[model samples]
Structures are given as C-alpha cells and as structure tokens.
Target chain A: MRPVADVLIVLALALVAASSTAAVLARDPVRQSTVLALLGLSLALLFAVLQAPDVALSQLAVGSALTPLMLLLSVRKVRRKGKEGGSHRNAGNRTGSTDQEGRR
Target chain B: MNGWLSAAALLLLVGFAPTVWGAASGPVRRRVMAQNLATLAGCLVLLLLAQGYARPSYVDLALVLAVLGPAGTLVYARLLADELAERPARDPVARALGRAMTPLAAVCVPLVVLPLCVATGPGRAMVKLLAIGALLIGGNIVSTRALSARHATGHTPRGTGHTPQATGPERHTTGGQSGAAGG
Candidate 1:
C-alpha cells in the first residue's frame, strides 16, 4: 500500500511539473489558460493522492475552472479595448490632419 | 497495492498524460478538447482513488468535478467562440476525437463504474457512483457538441447582438436537463 501510494504521488508530482512548465511555455494567453486548467487538474489529483480531499475539492473549483475563466475573460476584454483604442487613435489622427489643413 | 489503486495509476499514465500533451501543444480546438478530456480523466481518477482509499467521502471530489468539468469547457467554448470560428478544428485528429467522444464515454463509464458499484454493493453510495457516471457521460456529450465546428460556424455569423448570450443560456438549459435526467 505504501509503495502504491508513493507511486501515485510521484506520478502526480511529475504531472504537476510538466504541466506547469507547459503552461509557462505556452505563448498564447488562450493556450496558456487551457494549460493552466490542466495544471489545476493535475494539482488536484496530487492532493487527492496525498489524502487531502478537502484541499483537492477547493483546488478543483478554483484552479480548474475559476482561474481559467478569469484569464480568458481578461484576455477578451483587453483585446476588445486594444481594438477600440486603435480605431479611436486612427480617427483622432484623421481629425487632427484635417484641422491642420483648415488652419493653413 | 490494491487493484483500484493500480488501475488509477495506469489511467493517470495512459489516459491523463496524453491529454496533458494534447492540451499543451495543439490548435485551439484540440487544446480545448484535450482540456475537456483531462477533466473526465481527473474525475474518474478521483473516483478510483475514493474506492482505493476506502473513504467514500472522497467521492465528493469526483462528483464536484463531474459538474464543473463540462461547465469549464463550456466557458472556453463561449469565450473562445471567435477564435474557434476563425480557425476551426478540421484536422483528422480533432475530428477523430470528436467522433470518438460518445463511444469512448459509453465504454469507459460502464467499465469503471460497474465494477466499483459491485464492490460498493447496492446502497446510496452505489447510487451516487452511478449518478457520477451519468454526469460524466452527459457532460462529455454536451461539451463535445458545444466544441464542434458545425456548432461554431452556426453561431459565428450572429456573433454580435444577443446571439452569443442566448446560445450560452440555451446550452446551459440543455445541460441542466441532462443533469436532471442523469440524477
């Protein structure tokens, strides 16, 4: 039993290491969010193997779902803002150029 | 070193590892699909662990995962709708996975749950085990449908206005209905 538990723990820890690395290495925020969710799932499994069910439950909720959801929502909001900002800047430049012509 | 523990270990190596790889490096559609698969695998591992440790209380982790897994996938599907639409998952691997989802769940849920049910014998615990199995399958189907290209293309045209919001609620209601039936 001890050996089996050890095996599970080691395997889970390896998964955590690999997933965390992958999450960090992922370039796209969207992809990173997905990898981050996998990291949470692996972490929860590790907690379960370590005989901490309560911690596993909370980790599952916050790590797997909540964290990724927040990340993705932030990415969406930022992208939209960037798009609007670019267009607004273009419009402002256009108006400035026309005003300079009018003054001349 | 019980059989349940050994099985869980094997699943962690075989079922879960590939999902980690899949999610780590792939197209957005495949990564999302892999994330969904990881949740299913995670839920099953928790179930096996619950039985392996002889602590029925641990089953709640699996139960919670059963509910939250698909919901998380749905969030990805909704929020990443534009990306998914721009580059649809038309690859053979993604298509194969989408096609295999139902059959895989159909085989796995019973193969894992039936033995656990027998080991547990007939009781509330057994019923709860069964409910988790049902949720696992239902959620898999719902999320697979939600992630498929056809669904993305169908919803992408009306991406603005209330269409995205409406589709999210509509899918949620369908998931709720499935949960009701499963429970």
Candidate 2:
C-alpha cells in the first residue's frame, strides 16, 4: 500500500507538471485556460488519494469550481474584445481605401 | 493501493496535458487562469503528501490555500481589467512595487532557510515553505501586471466603472461623448 501510495504521488505530480506546462505553453488562450481548469480538477483527485478529505474538498471547490469559472469569465471577456476588434479591422479596411484614393 | 492511486494519477494526467500546451505559448489573460489550474494540481499533490505523512498541518495549509485561491484570482482579474481600461500612462508606484518583489523574495529566503535548517533538517517542511512562497508571489505578480496592463490599454469591459446606468451602444456614445467633453 505504501509503495502504491508513492507511485500515485509521483503520477499526480507528473500530471500537475504536464498540465501546468500546457497552460503556460498553449497558443490559444481559451484552450490554455480550459486546460488549466482540468489541471485543477486532477489536483483535487490527487488530494483525495493523499487521504486528506478536507483538502480534497477544498480543491474541488476552489480549483475545479471557482478557478475554472474565473478562467471562463476571462476567456469570455477576451473573446468579446476580439470580436469587437474584428469589426474594427473591417471598418479600417473601408476607411483605408478612401485614404488611399485621397493620397493619390 | 494501486487502485485509487491509478485512477487519481490518470485523471491528473488527463487534466494537465492541455495546460502545459497552453503555457508554452505567450502569456495572456487566460494564461494566468491556466497557471492557477496548474497551481491547484500542485496543491493536490501537496495534500497527498500530507496524507501520506499523516500531517494535520499540511491539510490546514491546503484549506487555507483553497479559500485564498479564488479570492486571489478574482482580485488579479479585477486588476487586469483596470490595467486594460486605463491609458498607457504608467504609474511610478506600481513600477516600484513590481521591483520590490524580487528583493522581498531574497529577504524571505534567508528567513525561511535559517529556521528550516535548524528544526526539520532537509525535508518536507522546506518544500512546503517553497510552495507557499511561490503561490503568494505568483498571485501578487499576476495581479499587479494585470492592473498595469489594463491601465495602459484602456480596454476593459464596459460597465466596470461607476457611472449612471446607461444601456446599449447608444449609452457608450453618450457616455464617451460626455467623458471626452468633460476631459
């Protein structure tokens, strides 16, 4: 049981490291953030394995629930801003042509 | 034994894979959230460590962290929102605060190290201290940078600041006009 526990701990740490690296490395912000949320959930399980129910529950509440929600909110904010930007680019294209003709 | 651990470890892996992929990319607002996820995973690992050692203290720390986690993130998000909303003008105080963090870390290291060396030998307590310090510093940096960025970009979500309730795009036009006119 003890040896198995050690293995679980190692594996949990590996997952944490991998997910964190992904969160940091991913190109798409939304994807990265979502990955991050997943990482949090995984950590919650690891806590459970460690036999700390209190800590495990806290991980579930904060890491899986609250943290992810916050990330999602941030992602939504970014997406809205990006959509607004797309509109700006389209507007620029229309006005740009006018300026070009004026310059000529 | 292997049964519970296997399932738990597998879940951790599944959760973490995407986060690492994201982090490799440039830092962004979302990246901060992603890092938080990773931090949570680390916290879980710490919980397991505590359980394995039968230490009540580790569980207590985890509980504290769990509460702090969301609160800290929310604060950081608000700061980031502010940074994006503000103009490009940099606040000297913010810059100074940012610079101070490194020195503070340096000071903290010795304070932690001296006691750690005397009491527990080179063990789990050292790891705990490092984790705590990292989490706190990481949270602080995320908040401050976001605040500064929001300030420089003037790109915050609408309705963040206090003003009379104005609805729709027309409200922005009126509000913006008034703001511009006022300035």
Candidate 3:
C-alpha cells in the first residue's frame, strides 16, 4: 500500500476475504453464522475506513446482531420442525397397515 | 500508517485472525465465544482506526459494534441454549475455554477502550465514547454472566442455577446435550 489508509483498507479486505472463505466452507449454519459475523465486522471497518459511515452503520446493525440472530432462529426452528416431523412419521408408520386395509 | 493505524493493523493481524480461526473451525460453544471475542477485538480496531484516521465520526461504527456485539452473543446464548444444553460438561476443553477467556475479555476490552477515551479528549465525542465503552463492557458482563449461568446449570446439573433454566424456556433455558461438541 502506498500510504497508511491503503494499508488499513487492505488489511480489512484480507480479514473479510479470510472470514468469508471460512463462512463459505462451513456447512453448519451455526458455525457459519459466527464466521459471517466476523466477516460483517471486517466489512464494516472497511466501509468506515473508506469514508462510508452510512454504510458502516447499517452494516454494523445488520451484520453484528441481526444476521446471526436470524441464522440461529432459523436453525432452531428447523431443528424443532425436524423433531416434529420425526414424531409424525413414526405415528404414520404405526397406522400404515390399517390405512392400507381401509383403502382396500 | 501512524501509531493509531499501526495499532489497528497490528490488532487485526494478531487479534482477529485467531478469533476467525476459532470461530470457523471449533465446536459451536467455542465458536460462540470466538464470535464474542471478535466483537470485542473488532470494536478496539474500529476505535483505533477512528483515532488513526482522525475521523471522530468513525467512532460511530465502534459505538454500534459495542452495542450490538454482546447483544448478538446473548441472542446466540439464548437461542442456542437448547442445542448447547444438550452437550454435557464432560469436555474439559470447553470448560477451560470458558474459564480462561471470560476474564481475559472482561479485562482486555476496557483496557483497549480506556485509552481511546483519553485520546478522544473531553467533548461530546468523549462522552459518547465513554458511553460506548460502558455499554460494551456492561453488555459483555451481562452476557458473560448469562453464559456462565447456562453452563453452570447445564453442565453441573446439580447446581442451583439449574432450576430456573428448567422452569423458564423462553428467556434463559438450557438443556443437557452431551453428544455434540466441546469446541
């Protein structure tokens, strides 16, 4: 980098790049949410260094808290749904033969 | 880069890299702590960057982070409580991690914020910086307490904190799942 700002910006970019790569590689949404939060932090810093406070502010709000909360909520809801589905499937199997006889 | 920017760069290099690595590769419990550490480190970096760039307005970014970072962690602790609770206390690593890192963060975050407060000087911005510092530190305390409470109850099983966690599923509910992970 030619100067300090350029160097800081580059560092922020590197932080973003590294964490984003990790986020992509992570299959677990829980882990991915953590990495994504780190990515958001670096991105916000990048924006702030680049003189985009407005962008940084919005990014901070969404990235630091909102995105992770959303991801965790969805993960919880999905897990709960899976459990419910499993129970329903077991119930269906128990009545499978009776239902077949009724159809005949 | 000047001293401030240099410090920012150094913090990014030394501090955040490990948090990213920890958050990325570890078990969910470890990842949550790493994520919290990232917020603390990220705030310090932003504060340094603001001072380095002489853009007091840039502190807004840090302020927002201070407010949201722990808030995010608490959200994870709340939502992930069930999943996390299922994991039992056998993993010494996670327990050690919780024990070691909590004090480190409690001390380190404010250590970083204090100088930024001094450098920021006496003004509305200084007051804002102090408020941000207070929020960041205060939020970290509450969330850390919440995390410890969850772990103490979930892991210890016989601990006093267990009853409330059981009775309340909405706010601070914790389960006892041991099959998942210690990272």
Candidate 4:
C-alpha cells in the first residue's frame, strides 16, 4: 500500500508539473488556462492520496468550479475586443513574434 | 502534522506561480479560472490536512481562503476589463505604488511565518490568520496594479484563437501588454 501510494503521489506530481509547464509554454491563453485547470485537478488527486479528504473535497469544488468560470469570463472579454490586425498577413506576423519574444 | 501540511503548502505555492505568471501572455479568463482552480486545490489540501489533524478551526480558515481567492481574482478581472476598454496609461503614482508594495509584501511573508514557531492553541489560529491575510491582501494589491496597466495598454487579451495572420511581429510589446492586463 505504501508503495502504491508513493507511485500515485509521484504520478500525480508528474502530471501537475507537466501540465504546469504546458500552461506556461502554451501561447494560446485559453489552452494555457485549460492546462492550468488540469494541473489543479492533478493537485487535488495528490491531496487525496495524501489522505486529506476534506482538502480533496474543497479542491474539487473550488478548483473545478470557480476558477474555470473566471477564465471563461476573461476569454469572453478578449473575444469581444475583436481581432486586432484583422487582415491575414499582418495577423500572422503579429502572433508569431508576439509568441516567441513574449515567452520568457 | 507540520511536515505534511508544510509540504502541501509548498506544493500549493508551486502550483500558483505558473498560473499567475501565465496570465501575461495566456488567456485572461482562463488564467483567472486556473488561478481559482489552483487556489481551490491548495485550500482543499490544507483542509484535508486539517481534517486529518482534527482541527476544525483550520478548516474554517481554508474555507475563507478558498472563497476569497477566486472572488478577489474575479473582482480584479472586472477591474482589468474596465481598464482595458479605456487606456489609463500608468503614471508615476502607479509605478511608485507597485515598487513600494512589492518589497513590503515580500517582507511580510517571513513575518507571517515567524508566528508559527511558537504557535499553540488559539495562538496558532492567529498565525494562520495573519499569513492568509497577507497573501490575500498582497495578491489583491498586485493584481489591481497589473489590471490597471493592462487596461491602459490594451495588452493581454484572453482569446487563444489568434490566427498567425491576425498577429504581427511587433506584437511582442503587445504580447507583454496582454500578459499584464489582468485584474
């Protein structure tokens, strides 16, 4: 059982870590945010394995519920702002440099 | 008890960092959501540890943190939205405030943690409360500044659907703007 728990914990940590990396590397904010949600889910699983039931419950409830809702709200706001450089040629150039240099 | 809780707390902090930083170039709505989700997960971890320890008081504290974290993020987002719609260009006052708050907030973490060493019974609650208060207040102030900048600059829009054609090479600065445009 201890070994199983350890493996689970390691797996959970790996998943969360990978998703977090993806979240940072992802250029699309929407995709990044979604990946973040996945990271949160992995964290909750970690807590559950660590034997914190109440903590796991709160993680599921708040992490799964409120956070994503807020992200969606922000996404809507961005979409409403409309496409910045509407034309194709400029848009491609804009997003490309924006993604490359913008990433730290 | 301290060991497990501390580890859990550290994990929570680690999870929060990426989500927070991701807001700059990532989706605002999604980042906020991720922020809330991360907070919730952290809170849940805290709550679980508290339960195992049979500490109801800690549970209450976790509840407060969970609710406040997302609500605060939402308020900050709304503020960002309003700011973005109209350019409010950052002035000396805002910059000065950011500079002042950043260092002061950094120092508070140790102060918040110090109380835990001797924390016992009700005193422990005080320690936890102070720590939580610092985090919540600090997060609010910082996020508000960021939102103001984003609004002033029209950077950090939330959509991920930008086709390459819609983006420009000089959009790098714009990218910087979007990253910071959250509440």
Candidate 5:
C-alpha cells in the first residue's frame, strides 16, 4: 500500500513527460491544441501531488483553459489571414490550399 | 499509502493514461474527446487526493477543476467546429466522454463524497463536497451535450440543409464571428 502512492507520483510524472513530448510533436494546430490541453492537465496533476495546491490552482486555470484558448485563437487568426490572402488571389482557393500549408 | 491515495493512483493510471495517449495522437474529434476524459479523470483524482492527504481544503482543487474542465472543452468544440465538421471521424472519444461525464460521474462522485461526508460528520465540509460533486456532474453533462451538438447538426446552418454548395468561406467567417462572440 505504501508503494502505491509513490507509484501515483511516478505515473503522474510519466504522464507529464509523455504529454509534453506529444504536445511538441503534434502536427495539426487543432490536434496540437488538444495535446496542449492534455499537457496542462498532467502538469496540474503533478503540482497537486507535490503538495502545492495554490500553484496547482493557477496551473489549472492557465493550462487547461487559457492556454488552449490562446493557442487555438492564434491559430485561427493565422488561418484566417491565410484564407483572406488566398481569396485575394483567387476565390476558388479555400482552407488547406494555401502554399504555406507545407510549413508545419 | 492510504486507501484513498491508492485509489487515486490506480484511477490515474488506468483511466487518465489512455486519455493522454488518445489526445496526443488522433483526429481532431478524438483528441477533443480524450481531453474531455482527462478533465473528468483529473477531477476524480483530485477528490481522491483530498481524501488521501487528509486535507478537506484540497477538495477545492477538484471543485475548481470540475467547473473549468468542461468549460475548456466547450471552448475547444466551439472554436474548432470547422475542423470537426470537416468530416466525421468516428468519434469513440465523444462516447467515452459521455461515459466520463455520466456513469463515471454518477459512480465516483457519490461513492467518494458519501464516505467523505460520513467522515466529516455532517458539517459544512460535507456540504461543500456534495455541492462540488453536483456541479461536476452537472457541468459535465452540459459540456457533453454541447460538444456533441455540432456532430448532430453537422455544423451547417439550420435552414441551409438543402444546399451543399453554400458552404463557402463567407459562411464559415460568419460562423467564426459568432463563435468568437460566444467564446
């Protein structure tokens, strides 16, 4: 029974590691936003386990909600800019058709 | 090392880990569902943590998570409707989210809170726990419905069902503006 709590901390840490890596490695902006949200979740869990509830609270707010909001908003703005540029050139070009699609 | 801590750990491993993987690698809808699951699991884990560590104050963490988690997922669903509505991606994730919010919430909240209530002996703390559990389950249900609504309507305008050709960037721009307002 004693070892199990330690295992929890270890697993939370593992989750943090795996999710952070995945957040960076993710491709699509929308999907990456999901990974970012996951990263925030695990990180908040880690903070809670370490006995820092205050820090964990802030982390929960910023990590889970705000970060995803900011990331998705920025991505949306950039995508909109791209679409406006495309429609400028030719009305036929919709989303995912911009030449910059190969960037990331 | 206690029963609550052990339970929390086990729940995290079994329930939360898969969500991480699901959110990390999948289609947009799948990731959204996984993120929703992660929030539910995280809230439950925090409740266990509160009991495990013997700190009534810690339950506040779970309470806050319960409120904010679904809010975040709802925001994701609204903003990313275009991507999700691009095509249905066979969302087992959403069904899993329904499970997280419904049956899991039904099972875990009462199970933990009841015992915690007994332990706290019908005080203000017990009241707080009950309230948190209610809020968690209620918020989860609302968020689940909102997330799945786009899938139901196929993200098209209500009256425009007859015209497949009407889905141009202009329509999406209007949709995006409304979504931004909602966000």
Candidate 6:
C-alpha cells in the first residue's frame, strides 16, 4: 500500500513539474492560459495525493477555473488594445508626416 | 498498493500525459480540447483517489471538478470565438479528437463509475457517484457539440466564398449566434 501510494505521489509530482514548465515556456498567452489550467489540475492531484483534500478543493476552484479565466480575459483585453493602438499610431504617423511635408 | 490507487496511477500515465502534451503545444483549438480532456481526466483521478484513500468525503473534489470543468471549456469556447473563427480547426488530428470526445466520455463514465457504484452499493453515496457520472457525460456532450458547432459555423462562410468583405461580418454574426447558443 505504501509503495503504491508513493508511486502515485511521484507520478502526480512529475505531472505538476512538467505542466508548470510548459505553462512558463508557452509562447502564446492563450496557450499559456490553457496550460496553466492543466497545471492547476495537476497541482490539485498532487495535493490530493498528499492527503490535503482541503487544499486540493480550493486549488481546484482557483487554479483550474478562476486563474485561467482571468489570464484569458486579460490577454483578450491587451490584444484588442494593441490592435486599436497600432491602427491609431499608423494613422497618426501617416497624417503627421504628410502635414510636415506640406509645411516644408 | 491498493487496486484503486493503481488504477489512478495508470490513468495518470495513460489518460493525462497526452492531454498535458496536447494542451502545452498545439493550435488553440487543440489546446482548448486538451484542456477539456485534462479536466475530465482530473475529475476521474479525484474519484479514484477518494476510493483509494478510503475517504468518501474526498468525492466532493470530483464533484466540484465535474461541475466546473465544462464551464471552463465553455468559457474558452465563448471568449476565443474570434480566434476559433479565424483559423478553423480543420486539421485531421483536431477533427479526430473532436469526433472522439463524445464517445470517449460515454465509454469512460460507465467504465469508471459502475465499479465505483458497485463498491459503494445502494445508498446516497452511490447516488452521488451516479450523479457525478451523469454530469460528466452530459457536460462532455454539450461542450463537444459547442466546439464542433463553432468550428462548422466559423468555416462555412469563408468556404463558400473568399471575399474578405463578405465574410467578415458574416463570420462575426455566426460567431455571435454560436456564442449565444453555447452560453
């Protein structure tokens, strides 16, 4: 019983480590949020293996759902802002350069 | 050491590892699909763990996961509508996964939950387990339907004609409609 439990704990720990690393290394913010959710799931499993049901429950709520949702929302906001800003800057640059040429 | 623990461990290796890999590096569609799969796998693992540890109370964890997992996937499907529209998940692997999602849920729920119910016998606990299983299968079906529906709608307008001007608003309208339906 002890040996099997130890094996389960180790497997879960490995999953946690791999997922956390993947989350950090992910290039796209959207992909990162996805990986982060998986990371949360793995961590909750690890906590469960460690006999910490209370922690696992909270982790399940926050890590799996809340954190990823937050991350994805923020990413969406930033991308929208960036798109608007880029178009605005391009317009400003074009107009400003033409105005300077006319004055010159 | 126990059969339950061994089962959990086996599932961890077989069921979850690929999902982690799939979620980590893939197209957004695949990643989202993988994340959904991870949640399902995670919920099952919790159930097995509860049995392994001889703590029925721990089933609550699975219950919470069962409820929350599909909600998260729906959130992704809703929020990432534009992205999903821009690039349809037409890749063979994504299509295969999307096709498999429902059948997998249908099969796995029974495979895992029946044994659990047998172990638990006829009681409130057994009922709770059955409820979780139902929720899991139902959630999986809804989410997969949402995903495939979104994919179909996202692709149709563009496929019919390549006019960017024509498809842009059309795509948005379709995406909006699907989002409403999914929500």
User: Model 3: residues >4 Å from true position, as ranges?
Assistant: A87-104, B88-97, B158-183
Off by over 4 Å in 5: A87-104, B93-101, B155-183
| Angstrom error at residue B54, model 6 | 0.7
Model 1 steric clash pairs = none
Instruction: Identify the leading candidate in terms of DockQ.
Output: 5
Instruction: Report the candidate with higher TM-score, 1 versus 3.
Output: 1
| For model 2 chain B, the run of ten residues with the poorest summed lDDT | B82-91
> What TM-score would every model get versus the actual structure?
0.83, 0.34, 0.79, 0.32, 0.81, 0.85
Q: Say which candidate scores most in TM-score.
A: 6
* Minimal lDDT window, size 10, model 5 chain A: A89-98
A40-99 in candidate 5: lDDT tens per residue? 889989988888899999999888788888888998787778777764422333344333
Stronger candidate by TM-score (5 vs 6): 6
Q: List the residue pairs that clash in candidate 3.
A: B30-B183, B85-B175, B85-B176, B85-B177, B86-B176, B86-B177, B86-B178, B87-B177, B88-B178
lDDT of each: 0.84, 0.49, 0.75, 0.50, 0.77, 0.84
* Candidate 2 off by > 4 Å: A85-104, B1-183
TM-score of model 2 (CA atoms): 0.34
lDDT (Cα, 0-100) at A84 in candidate 4 = 56
> Which of 3 and 4 is ahead in lDDT?
3
RMSD of 1: 8.3
The residue-by-residue lDDT of candidate 1 on B1-183, one tens digit each, is 299999999999998988999899877878888988899888999999999999999999999999999999999988988656655455566667777876787788889999999999999999999999998998887787778744546445445545666567656765675565455
TM-score, candidate 4, is 0.32
Scored by lDDT, the top model is 1
Residue A16, candidate 3: Cα error in Å is: 1.0
- Report how far residue A58 has shifted in candidate 2, in Å: 1.5
Give the CA lDDT, 0 to 100, for residue B73 in model 6: 90
Q: For candidate 5, lDDT tens digit of each residue in B92-144?
A: 66555644555676686687778777877887888888887777767665666
**Residue-level error in angstroms, candidate 4, position A10:** 19
